[model samples]
Target: MRQVLLINKDPDMHSDLNSLFQENNYESVILDEVETGNEALRKVVNDSYDMLILNLDLPNTNMLGLINKLRLLNQDLPILIYSLELEYIFIKRYLTSGVNGYCFFKNGDVGEILDAAVRISTGKWYISQEMVELIVEKALYSKKIDRFDNLDEQEFEILTHLIKGDTVANIAKIMGVHLPTVSVYKTRILDKLRITSLLELKNIIKIPLLSES
Candidate 1:
């Protein structure tokens, strides 16, 4: 039987998911359920599970940090993100962070969820067709004017840190540079990306993921 570790804070959703898994006839069992990222980490470290269904909105832990930690702990374990967050950027980010599948709760039903679980358990990526089309469209548009390609290594690093909510001083300290130097890098990055402010930069990053129609 396939063992699944479910990490979600909503008791109703948890119960519903558990019931779906049990009734699907997929020979899968929700071996453990965790309400927080810390709890998920504890269970993951101590137990063996075939797959993980993660909710990205866990209150106690940073989502990206937890995903990174889990990837380090079990490189081969399949992780399926079952999240209400349907932002294409977040979906791309999660897949890049080593999640095997994404099931947007807003757009998915029990069938999609079950399919994601089965496909991910078999080492296949599971994403909705609409998401796939959006990714492809964005890829084509990106090839036309790849703004990120213009950033140097340092500028790219600075941009990443900035997006991660790092302050200019913090970035400077982390990069072993003066505050003014980090500020200069940030300015150059903004110029190269063709964006004026951090807010614009964030919005630009999300643009590709936005619905075309």
Candidate 2:
């Protein structure tokens, strides 16, 4: 059986992936971390697995460093980035950083993700067809960078949280700000992106490329 390790903060999502993996005759260890950071990296360093499905939006540690360290430790380890945020640039950067595969929670059909795992295990790099189109579209529209670039650091953080489906109150709690503060950031984020509604913002950032079509 193929061995896989999934590092995600959400238990429910991990469970879903675990169930699916079992159905397909793959052995998987689902690490459900409520808040993983550098400490989680320690576990990663010690465990041996055929593949890794990492949540790039993890709140606990320097995600880039974790990937780098993993690469340094085991160059052959196949790493698959899994996240809810499907920003083309982020995916592009991850590709440049040496991930073997990439998939997003919002964008890919569940079957595609399963296929990605199988392909990765077979030493193939697999990016869904829908993600390819999004990457191409974003590249062609490179001139419109400011659509997201105008956001301040805090605004960017807030926007990413929103992309991960955090509500205003949850965002406020996470950011340790008052509800009004999160509301203000949300409004500014929408205005800066020239989107008038939350749904539009979600459409732009949360919906996967496949779902968009």
The prediction achieving the highest lDDT against the true structure is 1
Q: lDDT of candidate 1 vs native?
A: 0.74
| Worst 10 contiguous positions by lDDT, candidate 2 | 204-213
Over the stretch 103-186, how does candidate 1's per-residue lDDT look in tens digits? 877743756877888887777899877678778987776545456656665676566678767888877765668999998898
Q: What lDDT does the true structure give each of the candidates? A: 0.74, 0.68
**TM-score to true structure, per model:** 0.71, 0.60
Clashes of 2: 3
Q: Hey, what RMSD does candidate 1 come out at?
A: 5.7
> Model 1 clash tally?
0
Per-model root-mean-square deviation over C-alphas? 5.7, 6.7
Evaluate residue 128 in candidate 2 and report its C-alpha lDDT on the 0 to 100 scale. 62
